[model samples]
Target: MHPTVSGSGRLMLGFQYFLHFSVMGIVLPYFNLYCFHIGLTGFEIGAVSALRSAALVLFSLVWSILADRYSARKPIYILCIFISTGIWSLYLFTVDFWMILAITLIYGIFYSPVISFLEAFTMDALGVEKTRYGSIRVWGSVSFIAVVILIGKIIDLYRIDVILVLVLLGASLQSMASFKIPEVKRSRKHQAFLFPITLFRKEVIVFLGCAFLMLASHGAYYGFFSIHLESLGYTKTFIGFTWALASLSEIGVMIRSRTLFKNYSLHTVLVFSFMMAALRWGCLIFFRSAFTILLSQCLHSITYGAFHMSSILYMDALTPDDAKTVGQAANNAVTYGLGLMTGFFMAGALYEPIGAKGLFAISGIIALLAGAIFQTMGKRIKVFPP
Candidate 1:
């Protein structure tokens, strides 16, 4: 493997995450719009959107297993990312529903692992000081906000097709930058067999379950918010600006998280986050005022921002010191890989009949469940300091 991430490498790894997920934010928000721009109806749009989640379910484990077995982190990230980017590139010419569906499926299988492996790569390179992970991760949010507002303005003047081209270019840049990241291998002893269930302990299982619910709560906003705005007669430019407003809040939390998480346990941060999600989404359910929409979006900081940092910290604290690599992979497998897929699939059907208000009500309840579980049972966790 190339020389491990010295201090210099950590900064580069951060930039890579920023670049990679930024591409994700740019494309994901507009994907449903693209489907509608074609002939697809609402149902088709949800299904197409969920395809990325489906892809994660199909491939996250297989890729993680490969990364662990051979200790080949960088190559796996590079290859899978390249495949996903190439598939994304084809969207410019092809708008057929079946063809689009096929591309989504391929993207799923190849795409989910990039972030998992990359995050695992980050932890391996950074070592024990887990606080910095958020500081780096926030850059992805920053890039996302920047791209969303810019693309929004662009789309208002030009055709939506510009998104396809920009997304392809961003994905390609991430793939290229990934090449410079140092390799991370499962240490020799972990190379031997170990129980996978070790990942599913009291604190961990709760955190994962909570993370799943918290993400599920996002289904309405992520999949349906643009449509909601469209219905409300907001222009594409305004919608994009609103979306960026949320990420801008998220960036603030991420920048402050190292200090916040350091003083407060990860559980403290998580409990507060889930509570905020409930309040934010609940308000969305009852209130349609623009101020409420803007207010709720700002809370993305607590709903997504703080909870994500806490989840990473919780993962580091819970995993056996020997199993750090596996721990990171398991987080992706449960939270993003499986949990996210489950949420998106359900949201596709639910959002159509229920509408945003009903959809968000359920989101509030789910976030409450997540919070209750974390607050009551999380105290019993063994690995975390009391």
Candidate 2:
């Protein structure tokens, strides 16, 4: 059998995460704000984001299926990155909402699967060292913090239109870095086990359901947090700082992920994250002060950092070795795709009628419900070894 990826390859993996998420750092915080600047309606913004999420679900699955079927994850991955980078360049030529939405949909077709595939590759490369994923993934957070803060300041000095350029630059670098990713070949014996029936245990279903709700609750924050801040009269720099703060807090949890998972059960971490998510959103419902908002951002340590790492590890343990790509794909599709799509649509539809405050209230309730149901149903789940 071919050996697992070595130390240099792991470093390449870290670099890949850094570059991939650098683009995310641009899009996540500022892309919608860019849309707002161009006079897109709230619903139109939501439609763009929601359709992109839909592409994540549909296209990511198709890519993963091909990856597993042909044992060609790396080639498929590289192709997607290059193609998506090319697609994203089309943004420069248009400010029309319909054109932008179409571009987002096309871009999503190639962009959606990149992360899930990277994650699956990461798990395979790490082998027994999976728990340390946070350390490597932490590089993404670092780049994210840097980009958001820098872009925020840049936007204050210039136009929001710069976001389009920055995203293209980041994505182009990611495509170049994609060539160095190490391939992990599976044994012929394992090839026969793709998408086995046993992959969908009740525990997996419950965890995924809870994960979906958790991400769904993030709809308001991801889709419109910058616009919400602007509505509150905050400057672009401050809005960027707020987003950077969340990622900064997320870094701490990720750095200590090995210790954290060793001391607490995934069940415990997941429930606590949900509880923190509820509290975080609930705070936004009543407070608008800078201090309060930054404090709320700190809770991202639990809400996203701990919860995400645990979800990845849990899914890795549950999936069979041969089916790792599809396993991660399913996880991504369910949480980021379906969950975020629903949340974005809900937030978009309701933003005009109820505003950000009302959206946060609904989000808090959704988070609480996720925690409650998971705590009750997830107790029986077996904790995988870190």
Candidate 3:
């Protein structure tokens, strides 16, 4: 039977997005900053970020394989949610670099698959009305904006360590909500024992390569943007506002996803997003004024919001029905996992030598390069035939 999602199922899925991203709002802006405050060097923080991404590369695939093989996506999804939450609590017990690094790896093993699994579920749940994905996915951006704005002020009022408690609480609640996720029954016809070779099609490969570079270009921003802000003498509240602003723009694009995709090809949106990322990072390289910074932040509507939705939809279009979970897992692994891993390590290694401004310059170049290569090759090679 074709998969079907009920109203309550969609509600639970939206709740999952909110809770998961709310925790992300905490970690993305503050976790590395917390490390910095506690005396971890730039390299150490980068290592932590890269290692977690590495876990995503390896483990997301493993979990997806099992889920596809056993048809137990719900059970596996719930298991990872709870286990990762439990592991994250270990952060409260130690601040030592090595110990924290170890914890990050273990936590990442469980945490890595959660988002990919969630994406697969969302895609499956959306079913025939998948174009409305933006409506459901907007919940994540909503929670993210709210948390970053709220936590920024709270951090100004209290200790940075408070982030740990808030993240734990958010995750704990997410774990509880995981129980509400309705099981999605995939068609047995999609059941397969081997990875579909179509996954290696020239178009898919080219697309993934371009996507990899696009995300890799974000390494400096995601890994060090908060630190960059603080180094510029911006307050925690200001940093929070800046991050929240990005998500706010992201929500605008996401809210318009259905219309955007209907009017433009996924290929066009991806290319535009890549070009905008280059421009956005270039702005960061030269400007430090609040107005300029905020202006550039708005480009996130294209850079991340449009790029991400396009990438997901593109991969869905390319993959075989049997390998839906695996396709999203691969997308997450290549872009967010390996791509971010490379970016984090590069940023970490260079942060001390070149600083955040220098890192932004390099990131801009990487993004431009990705755009050029994809633009030229996509058309010449007929990667996305109309």
Candidate 4:
């Protein structure tokens, strides 16, 4: 309905989403399998996986701060993509566990910046009619499903090493897309040492903490869920399809997030998202039935898709334009980088003793705790650019 938001803007956002998620599909469904194929143990894989998040903890804040200061988003996004794709491609040559971990560590530092900036850029492109964001982001979910299914078929036929080839191709395409995206210049000029942490209000801190807890809960799933499925006698292809099904559901939810957000507050969405995530993981722990798992996976819409969209919108609505990119980045730093690193490490160390059942149960509990925390922060937390 808004003039600033256009079909063209949606198209550009969708294209960007496609590249970002396609890269993810290639990595998520296959990376752990590749690690196993090369001789890493479950513990080692968990450690290596955590290394990526650990690196993000170190660098995500710095990158987000840069985007806040610079205002030119596209160039920094491109640099991160090129770095991510380049280092992750190292899998083709290395079988050493430490080497793989090293690659993951380096890749995450650069890769973490893209999504944070891209969210800010896309919102700028959309302006008042941000309703279109979900429609555009759903394309990413759809592309992810397509790639996961395609790569699953390939893994069914060929050796797991073939995954690296797909990953390389995906990253290359993403980098090219990043290059083609036109830059959006922000109007607000920020001070050079505008450290947001110094000015972060209680609400922002609470929101960031809740987001961190939610992502931390996903640590087991993102780092090792694929491997867990395989360990449970599920084939790589079946595991891939599970991921695909979840994405399909996510796409559906994404298309409706605009309407959903219109009716609900951002805090309400976040609380609901974490509650659903708790349910999703809790259900996963109890039912190994394929249909049950499939249904639970579908709830990923509420769990991840809704959670992510709401977080960004909340950040957008609450923060100043000058601090928008930094806010997103700070959330990522704490959530993906720090929280994920912590989750993966805990999940890794605890995996063998607890098994998949116990691991997912913990994830569920954490989600519930996050939801409770968010509820407590309600109406009391400060909302702002400071």
Backbone-clash count (model 4): 0
Candidate 1 segments exceeding 4 Å error: 1-4, 184-192, 383-386
Q: Per-residue lDDT for 1-386 in model 2, tens only?
A: 11368889989999998998788888999999999889999999999999999999888978987888778889999999999999999999999998998999999999888999999999988887788889889999999999999999999999899999999999988898899998788653444246654346787888889989999999999999999999999999999999999999999899999999889988899999999999999999988999999999999999999999998998888777777788888889889998999999999999999999999999999999999999999997766623
Candidate 4 per-residue lDDT over residues 285-343, each given as its tens digit: 88877888788888988888888888777766666656667767777778887888888
Ranking by TM-score: 2, 3, 4, 1
Which sections of candidate 2 miss by over 4 Å?
1-3, 188-193, 196-199
Residue range with the least summed lDDT across 10 consecutive positions in model 4: 1-10
lDDT of 3 by residue, 187-239 (tens): 45434454556457778788889988998899999999999989889999999
- What lDDT does each candidate get? 0.75, 0.90, 0.88, 0.79
Q: What TM-score against the true fold does each predicted structure earn?
A: 0.92, 0.97, 0.96, 0.94
Write down the RMSD of all candidates, one decimal each: 2.6, 1.8, 1.8, 2.3
Candidate 4 at 211: error in angstroms? 1.0
- Report lDDT (Cα) of residue 98, candidate 1: 88
State in Å the error of residue 121, model 4: 0.9
Ranking by lDDT: 2, 3, 4, 1
